[model samples]
Target: MLMFASSRVGSVSAGRISNWIGHRYTIVVASTIFLLGSVLMGYAHAYAVLMAGRCIAGVGVDFSLMIAPVYSPKISSPSSRGFLTSLPELCISFGILLGYISNYLFGKLSLKLGWRLMLGIATVPSLALALGVHRMPESPRWLVMQGRL
Candidate 1:
């Protein structure tokens, strides 16, 4: 029962994540799926109710990934910065792995903490990154020397 719920959220999260970051239409589609899932979860009953939670959880996962790569270049520099910029996606993959590990190892946490916490954890880094991004300058930068000093 719980396993079904835990996995429900992870199922479609990948495809939605892929789509959401790529284009405007993708976001609309993702949002629609997310909204549908939220509605389903809210009023769910039977095994199917858990299923909707899964769907909602999956879309939440997508939301976590939606803006990650795009946030990279805007935060990084020209040389070696792309590597640093890649950290967002890198960390995302790592978090997925960690979540998998958690699910496998922490059965108690899964039952007690619930799937929502896992989804929230996945979102926190991205949310923090987004908040940090707002403080950044939206400008192209270069190393320049104005005077010999």
Candidate 2:
């Protein structure tokens, strides 16, 4: 519930920030936040820390969701726009399926280690996103809007 609340708030803020700083940096920011959240959750010894981590991660999720749909169409050719726009949804579903599998596999470990490993594993993709965002082209529409192109 807290996650959902924070996410809703974050989505609005992310949209504004993306407009100001551009979507590329917004994605990097979100990925960095997600990495932080994963580390916090992984090392958490207290309930408060876990909740904090969850809130941060929720915000990151919202930021990504808010930006991607808007950004995708701008980068894709008209003929491919429909497929490209749907890719995010497909990836999200695949991620959920992967999460379920990871949960089951990690659950087999000792309780203390299992949960930590499960949460910490998220850092891999988050880190990849943070690094990869730098390599991606900024939305051409955004560049034009900003008079940079």
Top TM-score model: 2
Local accuracy of candidate 2 as per-residue lDDT tens digits, 96-115: 99999999999999999999
Q: Show where candidate 1 strays beyond 4 Å.
A: 1-46, 63-66, 108-149
Give one digit per residue, the lDDT tens place, for model 1 in 40-118: 5544555667575565656544554554454356446678577967786788689778988865655556454454454
lDDT per prediction?
0.50, 0.90
Q: Positional deviation of 92 in candidate 2, in angstroms? A: 0.3
CA deviation > 4 Å runs, candidate 2: none
Candidate 2: which pairs clash? none
Top lDDT hit: 2
C-alpha lDDT of candidate 1 relative to the true structure = 0.50
For each candidate, what TM-score against the reference? 0.44, 0.95
